[model samples]
Target: MTSATLHGYLEQSARRSPGTCAAVEASSGRQITYGEIDRLSSRVGDHLRRIGVRPADRVGICLPKSIASLAVLFGILKVGAAYVPVDSLAPPARNAFIFNDCGVRAIFVEASRAENLRYELARLAAEPRLLPLDWSDASSPLATYLARVEPEGGLTVEDESARPGPDSLAYVLYTSGSTGQPKGVMLTHRNGSSYVDWCSEILAPDESDRFSSHAPFHFDLSILDIFVPLKHGATVFLIGEELGKNPTRMASVIAERRLTIWYSTPSVLTLLVEHGSLDARDDHALRFILFAGEVFPVKHLRRLKAVVPRARYLNLYGPTETNVCTYYEIPQTIAEDRSAPFPIGRACSHVKARVIDANGRDVPRGQEGQLAISGAPVMLGYWNMPERTSAAFHVNSSGRWYRTGDVVIEDGDGVYTFRGRRDRMVKRRGYRIELGEIETALYRHPAISEVAAIARSEEAGVSIKVFYASRDGHALSLIDLKRFCAHNLPAYMAPDWFSHQQLLPKTSTDKIDYQHLMRME
Candidate 1:
């Protein structure tokens, strides 16, 4: 109902519902009212100013998903600085690479994540500077850290006087990298706010709604989780860490807290069902179960419907470059559409999507091609790679289209179905990955000869399947391969299934035939 920027939205909410719960970390049983968040974020912003973090200086934040993370994000924006949210669980090298690539002026990290953060920073061949934020206490570690970084409180004259440009970078999110190197996507305030507006309206929940956030803070999905409730005067349930890690604890949370709306990937949902917690004993209060970041398994969707008869099940589709574009809302009272592959649904207002052939021409209805999305939500592109940014961010020959590399087919009904990626992309449990990126990591191993990674979807959701041509033919066991992957890559990016192969399928150009490898599994 509000057509405002993210800052405006939060400012308005704080004005109206000063005492209403703005954010909470269920893991620590801590809460921050909207007014408190406003005050704290501004104070943190003041601290940043005292330390000389000027407008648009990249400030890196690597923290657990909690009240502190949210504060860091808003606080960075308040000073007109852009935030680079690094997933705390990300591999140490990945964190270091992103920080170095973005030229982060300062870094705030949780104490638990400090060991890896420092290791990666030290490993960097370039500037090894790292500003660490220890989050062992305080509502948000950044809040207290900023307090120390700048002793004199109160917003500086420049901080209070400067205005935020609509096109200025709001935040940067580093998603799965195809080159085994994550890419930093710069999102402007307009892009982020427009997406926030679209979601708040489409979901259409008022203050009575309680949205649960299960996605990691760095993921774009978390944007909706953090902003939607604030955009509407509603409460957000930040699931505890133990609950996030252990399925059993989450079950108890659902029954005990009576959460109203839920957002997560299929992997987490499948875990809930597998653990035998998808029963009436759970809170019937969960009114909606929304899935995105990857494809949803219809069978699991069906199973979910059987348990929560009143919940609305929605399939949200979009890449990090753009917020959600298409959504399919299937109320739990209705059975799943298992007959035809579910449509990705229609684009939201200000968003337009088309299926185009290889040359970028529109395909006929019902034909398969790449997806091109045009709208305010189009990302500003990779932070520093101009050539890459130019190739991915395009001005349509017709002058108004940004192409998304997703291969999909458009139906006569104007809906789209995901075919696969035209690039080295893989979506597992709502996370987009680049197999080349994994291969890059594997090649780093002196013991590995050659390797390729791909995603395999199963009843258990999605797991990475890796194939290798080892140098010694020493019977690279799954355990060993996995151990190597864990040592060098993030857990989510690790290949779950390892297979030994003498050679891999190749095309006429001698390139790896990913399609053929997908068939062997």
Candidate 2:
């Protein structure tokens, strides 16, 4: 039978092709078939139920990306529970905050990481059951844990009444909040399935297709990487944390596995192109190179297209609240002199988008305004934070629309070009300026690899500070950078100060850590 929930996708695929390879460990070349994953997840679901986890309960997943983690994710959904994945690399104190905030019933974690998490949770007086994913230590042996928890003969029949529907909660993704705490964004099965359906219609993956899982489990991008491939009985190569950081190893895996579709942030794709030695590798199987999370420099994109001219490049744009609302397919040929960033194309077929002014009125074409999205892909709301959730959307006669907080100008043809974040625009010397615009101009310089522009307020006035990393660890002359900025940007928009680093700091999800830079003295 066809199913609407995320885990049901795996079930359907398993029934259709039981023996087909479902997932592969990129590091070890170990593979798991669809039937195997389905059965393992069922046993996991039985264990969760036996341990008193009820439908609609919240469960935490704190293990790194691996085949076992994927099974646990499906298992949570199988029992009609939403999984909350925390960054395994993050400190236990931070992970404890999320567990306490969400009030998770239980957490699936590796034994090595569980000690720290257990201590932090105890310190917070939050006692959630911790189920170890692996039993490496002598104290927690796999044999003993399995004998106690493993189901007899493995559960094959699912409790249909306990299965979640389209509107049931699927997962909660926590994002950095303005109040210096992480806020949980609640998403339903419908929220995930709608986007997955839209992508399946567009990409049309068959059972033979091989997709790359590059994004971390906690990131929103993983929604597409894990679910889309499973829905079509395709293979997903799980890129572990170590393998994800090494560009050469990643490139080799892509070539060896013959990955057809790749989805990740622009930063990762840029790293592969620059340092992965793709020019000498055989990666002709790549059909689609989809990127989001941050702007892609046109110069760098042009170079990537030159390297893999056969694949289609798409720029997907959206925030964590909405999975992906708008997308633009890059033209095969980009003029070498083109410097401006590409437009975030019109809204997806599953969603409706509007450019609204500050007063919540629709802005005319060619005017700058906030982009609002309303439709299937939009999230339910922030978990238990009704006041903040209400403020995040604009309600009207038509429907509730999510205010993206991104400032964009819609062209006459309806394509939207990102100007900057509403919070990133500042007034200096009586002139309004977009710090992202300044960063975009600086990226045109061949010497710059990564860049971030931040505005600071001082007793005297607002000052713009630019931080950048030069290509190949080469030192960039401040005078040369200032001269280039003056030529490309307006005098008022020019950065007042410039600083260089061998490499810019990145967040856990691999995006440039602008907040960290802002905190720098």
Candidate 3:
């Protein structure tokens, strides 16, 4: 592996193995080798420069998971431009919000979404040039024009070359915020490349290993699923979003593609278990399962382990700001920890983690505190929003560190376990409690499968509103669940209102969509 510099990393890999596989589309099965990626991305850079796109300008990508997406990304960065990844899978409003907020100057979108792009561009206060991408090999009418549009009026080639700096913006990833607005996290070139380097060091996946590119492009988790394989010169089989909606279909794609690596939110795994389908396990092709985003339901983990117990199960923890700050390889003991919500293992070697009390001082061991991370993986800040950025990426009086809103505790062994969220701490019956703490207790019941704890205030008392997903039509009454919680957790943390649903609402990245759920009657 080379240095963490973005261009240096991509350039070195291109030099080392130009013929190795770089990217492949899950839907069309189109593949691009490192050599093709280099050439096309170079051409794309040249094309962008020709069109007056300069360094630091935002370049929006609205394409699907395809070779072109990878090429365009490398190309945009090659031209010293920051890329804003807008998920084609995302809602049009969300996509439009990202583009407008970031002040994108150029866009690359799939032909299927070309109309939407046109409408959005028309509606924009200022219209940026929209480039329509065709996945097919054949040239479109635009290609002829694109060929003729070389650095037009630029006058010289060397002047238009891509100029990239490690500290410069690499991407702007949008995440749903508590206020219903999408917060755009601006990650530097180093932030992304450093993560790739760290992951490549931690899990040395090689070319022979074919991985799944099922995670959506918008999510940071897609880095491992998409780029890590490319960085290692490995093949990545694409699994379409259509198939991903049906876990069985997704599992079938995994088995069919003979995927060896997977990184997804635990909710997808829960869906697999609830459907009683382990498509990949039957074939035994999957050897690695790297779950991130949210806590994994232990029941599903046990079920999955029974099928592929030998598979390396890693619980990865991080925010959109930090690609991945910590990871814990499944210990030999697969038994559920009934004590806390779930242990997120230890902080990654690249990160400095501290569990601090409200006073911003380290708490005694085993005491609950907020988890703050200081590392290269921590994002530069929110794009152009200094106040919110300052709030998130702050240095304590002692040193420089970013405070992660998550609460956690450190064990004697130095391994940290997730406690809950700081905001989740709520006042109930004159008692302050963590809703996540109560939800963790609820899921421990054998009959309960997946559960979410929401704070609801009513005349009866301040109690929790739990939405759960159970297996095989199993049900747990509100009273029974409240009793179960009372036996395990404190009275203040117990839920009085409970709703059992087959599936919980999820975000675009597939984590439990709490805001959407809050809207549910």
How much lDDT does each candidate structure score?
A: 0.73, 0.88, 0.76
Show where candidate 2 strays beyond 4 Å. Answer: 135-148, 151-162
Number of the predicted model whose TM-score against the real structure is largest? 2
Model 1: which ten-residue window has the lowest total lDDT? Answer: 332-341
- TM per candidate comes to 0.78, 0.96, 0.91
Which regions in candidate 1 have their CA more than 4 angstroms from the true location? 1-4, 122-131, 137-155, 159-161, 280-282, 331-340, 424-521
Report the lDDT tens digits of candidate 2 across residue range 1-521: 23589999999999999999999989867679999899888877878887778789999999878788898899999999999999998999999999989999999988889999999999989999999866464332323455567654443455678778999999999998857789999999999998888888778898888999999889999998999999999999999888998988988888888999998888888888888977687556999999999999887898889888899988999898999899999998998788889999978889999999877899999989999999998999999899999999999998999999999999987788998889999999899998888988999988899889999999889999999988878778888988998899989898888888888888888888888899987
Which model, 2 or 3, shows the larger lDDT? 2
How many clashes in candidate 1?
Answer: 3
lDDT of 1 by residue, 46-90 (tens): 666766788878888887777877877788888888888876765
Q: Cα deviation of 99 in candidate 3 (Å)?
A: 1.0
Please report, as a residue range, the 10-residue window in candidate 3 with the lowest summed lDDT: 137-146
